[model samples]
Target: MGRKHLEEITLLRGLAIIGVVAIHSHPPPLSLGFLGLNKLYIEELSKFSVPLFIFISGLVLTFRYTGETIVYTDFLKRRFEKILIPYLAWSGIYLLYRYLYKSETFSLFAIAKKFLIGSAYFHLYYVFLILQFYLLFPLFLRLIQRFKNRKTALLSIAAALNLIFIAFYESTLLIPERLPRRIFIFWIFYFILGAVIGGDLKNNKRSAADKISYKLLIPLFAASLIYLLAPAGLPLGSKLDVFWLMKKTFFYAALFILLSYKLASESNFPTHNIALKPITSLGKYSLGIYLAHLIILEPLSTIILNRNLLFILTLSIAWFFTKTVSNLPYGHLLVGKINNSDT
Candidate 1:
């Protein structure tokens, strides 16, 4: 199936990028007033950004490859040239930042090893996650080909795997250091969901239930909120409360589906609306912005002297900066794709 311009995905990506900024940017110091609630709400909203991005990656890949004959070597080659190149470039950028600006010292060999593991920067774990998915892609496609008609069953199995992994993570069974918490198994469901959705779209056999709506989401959101309303100070970890991850994974997937359904609709969505265009552009450049934002945030924190103002200013800078970088030669090697020539 040939790909169309899915602005809705870009819109979601744009939203997710901002949500990430919100997560990293310091919120206004919580107050005794409703400001406290506001902060918590922002945190809850931002929790889904990482998962949504992973989901989109799975969706795009599955959408592209489901029915077509896939060349495994070609796929990996494309992934390496397109994704790994930029990943390494940005990784080196962050390592240099740490060494020079932050005054952290480490051997070149150690830095190389850290890059492999995605410890170069706090946010680079995402690249590691995607690499995991890429490594597993051919296998995923083989399974899909074998179980060509068993999408729901495959999805169910993947969901079960995710839950079981969570249970193990939360159990007394020691999670090995090599298999870190951010491993692909922990978020397998999203990738599987994407494959199922993508294949379904290709087959043109979409399920009505999968077409989420506001009616389905509102009650689900309420239940999720209640389930996740733990005390603010509760120690959170995979071991402590796997339900936190469970709730976030389910709720955000549902919410994203609902939002995508809406934005993907015909009449109400002004795809070219002037006001919304910047956000869509931001979404297009999200990868670069994701990589480069930390560099700016570091300096901005000290000079700005105000958290809220600093957050907005840094995002504005990062957005334009990322856009500029993406336009230069070899930019796609850095930021994935430019999305459009106009972009």
Candidate 2:
């Protein structure tokens, strides 16, 4: 079979990038009035954003073949070259900024420690998690592909395991707090969703009836509604139960995957134009955009916390600058060399 064209993947990449941008554009729960509404918005949107990213990562890898048998050494080398190298370089850049200008003084060891811990910034946490996912992906893909004919069973198992992990294991492990990076337990499901969906899409034996079910729009709308209601539904009067919220979010992630797949499967989306040029470029240099946006977002958020005009202006200006620099010849190379080589 021929390799799938790269156009849709580019668009999906754009969606993933925009989701991240949108997530950071919204303020945290504590900062918003009618905390429940804004919190629901942030929690729901942000939940979909990173999982979409992880799903895209796995989807891309599952579809592309390098010809040679997958080897952990080569995998690690390429993964590190793509993700970690850029991360480390950018961490140094940010560290230097903090050292010279910000109130904080950065020691070399402190810089190294922060980089390793992924606590240097909010987005860097993703960098650290992707590194972990990259190392395990080959094995993960191998195991997932084994269930090609048993997809329903496989999905059931994944759902069950996810519930168990979320309810039972995560707190005991305290993985996110203790680890070098923030470990989002739900993202593992996203990664698997990407792998499984991509696998089914690639499989030849599946009939047209199967594809029709994939087209239903109900799941997307339902998931969005559930996500919106969760905070309001479980308020402190009624403290919004975190456990129940997470459980619903897991369902939300699945619906998101369905939505993403449906969107990607479409041939009608706009594929050209000037206004979209920046976003399309963002898709191409997403890793750079992902890492570089935070450099602007954090401070901008501080400066424009409650001012609506300033907030919109900040997001627009930052998006422009981020897209501009991400597309530059050497700028792309520098960050691309480290965090993403897929483009």
Candidate 3:
């Protein structure tokens, strides 16, 4: 039988996309003191968004195909169709936008370089990063299977390596300055953790309740809150510090995964409530929103003075565009797969 649909995962996706938008929407200046601190808090908390998405990718992929024989070619073809094609389309769109408005010149070689490196837009690097993971997933799967009995050890090792890489990346010691941030090693721990959890959920048929507990939740919540309220000088520097930002985000992402699972397991949790409809809908069209939002936000920023209003308008426009395009012939090639059942 097919695995049950995960409404909680969709809910988490909705939350993640909101976080993504929050990070991009520039808030008031730090001179505003309390208001600035509030905005900074939200933005800092949202740092978990990207890592959470990466974790979900690993989880959903493993959950669906753990014990099955995956035809590697077919897998690549599907992933290419769903992800890479849209990435290329968006790259071209962004390139044209820059050439027309920003007076940026692009030669054939430059365009090709942008496509290869995901430099067409700031957000496109994530697509490039995910594509890298997709390409190496088969090898990762085999490795996971080879040591299936020692998942905890595998996760521990991956986390240690990830932390070490982050430290090296920050110090610029062994890692080359030219090495791109899109490298998989920088983010592999979250994916591997997700894969291990996915495998357990599949092999053991464990309920969401079994995957989380109050003992876990209480401590994670305390840690996250403490991290949020603590002054910038304490270890994790200002938000501008990439190393500390990523380190904290990794912690937040793990906490979120557990929290989401716990919420989904509750008997009275209202997945179909009217208040939640928009969030779940946003989750449904998250990829399209991710691709389209920056394009909309850049143009709209000139007209919308209020940052909050700009955020809402950008999300609304992107959602409308995504929903409209998803119905057109071969729209997935432009925006991404929109069908809720596909996930």
- Predicted structure with the largest lDDT when compared to the true one: 3
Give the lowest summed-lDDT range of ten residues in model 1.
Answer: 235-244
Q: Encode model 2's per-residue lDDT on 208-282: one tens digit a residue.
A: 223546436575557566655645544433222332225556677667666665655554444464655555555
Worst 10 residues of 3 by lDDT: 236-245
RMSD of each: 3.6, 4.2, 3.0
What is the descending TM-score order?
Answer: 3, 1, 2
Per-residue lDDT over 1-343 for candidate 3, one digit per residue giving the tens place of the 0 to 100 score: 4355556666667877888888777553454366666666766667778877887787777777788899999998988888888899999999999989899998999899999988899788889899888999888888778768877688889888887876666655455433546788888987887677667666765633355678978788679767654644333343233332355556666677667656754543445768788987888889999998999998898888777788788888998999899999999889899735224
Better of 1 and 3 by lDDT: 3
Query: By the lDDT metric, which is better: model 1 or model 2?
Result: 1
lDDT, model 3 = 0.75
What is candidate 1's CA lDDT for residue 340? 38
Give candidate 1's TM-score: 0.85
lDDT of each: 0.69, 0.61, 0.75
